[model samples]
Target: MKNPCVAHRGWSSRAPENTMAAIRLALADPLIEWIEIDVHLSKDHVPMVIHDYTLRRTTDGKGDVKKKTAAELAALDAGNWFSQKYQGEHIPTLAQVIKESVGHCKLNIELKTDGIRYPLIEQKVLECIQAYQAESEVVITSFHEGTLYRMKRLCSQIRTGIIIDGWRNSLPKELKELGADFLSISYSKLNKERVELLKNAGIQIMAWTINEKRAIRKIAALDPELLICTNYPERWHELRAESMELEVVNRKK
Candidate 1:
């Protein structure tokens, strides 16, 4: 099967990351199968889809995102920073994303609980997934091992991935014990030996934030099960097509 192309934060190259506009753009593209979104809890513990813990980078607000209520966050201008073309886009809640994404595409929701821990985030996210009946089409991921453990304990049926920035010898063993479905890692950390180790351990591999052609091509050569790219999913699509063409030629030769 061709490796799936996961949009980093929707088609965030054009729209504001984590907004509904970005999700819609990614859904419109046939090449993208998985839409990766970051989620944080609002003051009221509503799961809001966004990347940073702070709102300054993506929104017109000036404080920690957790400090704002969902209603307050809804009023912020989330699009103007990227482009005026999307001037009024607002951050979307995880429930809204799940509802909108139903029958459209799968979601890779990365719980943003690394630096700022949000109590019961796992429960809130799982509740959203269950409410939408999207367990078949959702994969929950996080850098927090405890969060992943909580998710698995809450719902073993829910597919889970652990996002790691660096290599660890105990990662495969840990994932196995945690009942993780995959390993989401930085593109630079993938090597032949690591890929073999992961594959041997029955773990799926996903590489992230790859945009440049060279980096994308290099990671593609590793043939990860999923390529999480920002700005240029089309490039990944092109490279995959080219790789398939080469495979066909080699078989005939």
Candidate 2:
């Protein structure tokens, strides 16, 4: 069975977080069976693949992502800050990323709604997914409950998940009510007891941004079937291989 190690932000530890350069590299690597990217509607209502609400952190632009038209967003240098060697790389629209990844691998497209909300973003993102006929290959997730609610209402058949970083007493009940397909939770919140709870509820679990070697092994030991979201998928693969090898040696002994 495949380990299902997801490349967070397109193998972001090596490439610029959400740029096409990152996405393309991840697609080319066979180790990365799943790629996670963030999505926000541009001013023109185009779904764009980017992590920040503002352009300052990842691109050379100055304002909010929703303020810029798709073309304007693509015009800025998104890779220069990561490294001068990647000077000309630009932000990719969600369509472009989907075009590159539709058949090669699955995507976990995060419906990014932080402080500034993009009104009607769920419909816009749905349009992009339908346009490419990638409804089956994508998993839409968000921290906002309303976003998931809207997405489920828009198309209940397409898989949707809720991203959680904290635990609450009502969580299992809330999740059961929400009817989410999976729970993408923070690494700190993942453990045997919680895993059993979610599994018993028939909810799939995904742990995110686990980059350290120790953390990777710990989670993999807890549940190898998890969709382990990591910045360095290469590291996860190495550790997974080592674990498998050790298991084989023990069996032979």
Candidate 3:
């Protein structure tokens, strides 16, 4: 099991995070196998891809994302904050992303729940995945316990994951109880011992937001199956190329 790279927010270092442009760009690359994005329900109950509960950070709109309809959110410019080149890039619906990624790669959709819990978001997400029969193509995750629980109960066929920002000694038991297929954690909290504990628990680890060359290598070395979630997939790809080159040079020597 080689440590695989998951493009975080879809090559976010180069494009706007969670936009269709970023997602498409990552999918275009033959090297990207998995991509992670955030999903929030609009006022009309459509699942849209964007990180925050509010739209101010990534869009020209200035209010809670839940207040707007999917079309309304789509009208806002989601890509200009990163650069003018993406000025007209709008927020993409989860269905659009699923349709776009049907044959390309897998998606890890994070259910965004900051303060207010969007009612029936779980059902909406399940229905969306079911509409496409994409149980294998999508994995739903969230920091909220109840969201994941509802998702598992609704459709056990689709995988569910926990987005953890901290560690606990009883985490293995907790994850097992929650029926998490995988767990994504901060890179700072990941180490060999923690990886072993989860592996023994029959759970997979996916480390988040690790960008530096050395840090990515350090974490990937711990477990070959570990999913190295990064903003720039190119860095990881470059590291692999460099390692192979070094291996060749060493053989020659």
Candidate 4:
């Protein structure tokens, strides 16, 4: 099967990250099979699409996002910081994201919990995915192994990915117990030896935040099952073609 190419945090290169515009742009691209997004609950327990715990980085507002209601978050200008063209984009809810990309692109929801709220996060995320009937296309990912464990019990059918920021040999064992389908880790955390080690263990590996072309080529040579990149989805067609051609030539032997 052709390896899946997921847009890290949506088509973040063109639009504000985690906003509806970024997601819409990602879906419009034919190369991306999945678009990854981050989720955090608002003060009222509504799931909103965002990457950070604080709104100061991505929006006009300045405070903990969890402390703000959906209405307060909506009133902030999420786009102005990126550029003036996107002057009024509001923070999107998880429901809105799922509804818009239901059939257009697969969803990779990364749970960003500020507290020990795994149960609520799992329930709310699954509820949203189920409401949109996006179970087959949605994959839940988290840096926390506990969250992955909680998610598996809630919905066995949904695929789960474990996020790692550091190197560890014991990850495969943990992933197996959690029933994780994939491993999503930072690009710096990957090496040729590590890639082969995980691949041999029947785990899919995906590296994140890789925007440089040379880095992409090097990682492509290592042959990960998926590449969750921030700025390279547009070039996926080219990269995939090169990889496939190499595979074909090698198969002739």
Please give, for residues 109-164, the per-residue lDDT of candidate 1 as tens digits.
99999634897799999999999899989888899888988898899899898998
How many steric clashes does model 2 contain?
0
Error of 1 at 121 (Å): 0.6
- TM-score-based ranking, best first? 3, 2, 1, 4
- Per-candidate TM-score against the hidden true structure: 0.93, 0.95, 0.95, 0.89
lDDT of candidate 4 over 1-253, digit per residue (tens): 2556778778888888988888888888877888889999888888899999899999999988888998898899999899999999999999999998888888879999633853488888899999989999888888887888888888899899888789889988888888986888998888888988888888877788777766777776677465656566766667668778988999999
Q: Which ten residues in a row have the lowest lDDT in candidate 3?
A: 113-122
Q: Candidate 1, 188: how far from true, in Å?
A: 0.3
lDDT of each: 0.87, 0.86, 0.88, 0.83
Model 1, residue 25: distance off in Å is 0.9
Which candidate number would show the highest TM-score if scored against the true structure? 3
What candidate 2 gets wrong by more than 4 Å, as runs, is: 114-116
CA lDDT for candidate 1: 0.87
lDDT of 2 by residue, 20-106 (tens): 888887898887788999999899989998888888988889989999999999899999999997898998988899888998999
Error of 3 at 113 (Å): 1.7
Q: Candidate 1 has what TM-score?
A: 0.93
TM-score of 2: 0.95
Model 4 accuracy (lDDT, Cα)? 0.83
Model 3 ranges off by over 4 Å? 114-116, 250-253
lDDT of 3 at 38: 92
* Alpha carbon lDDT at 61, candidate 1: 96
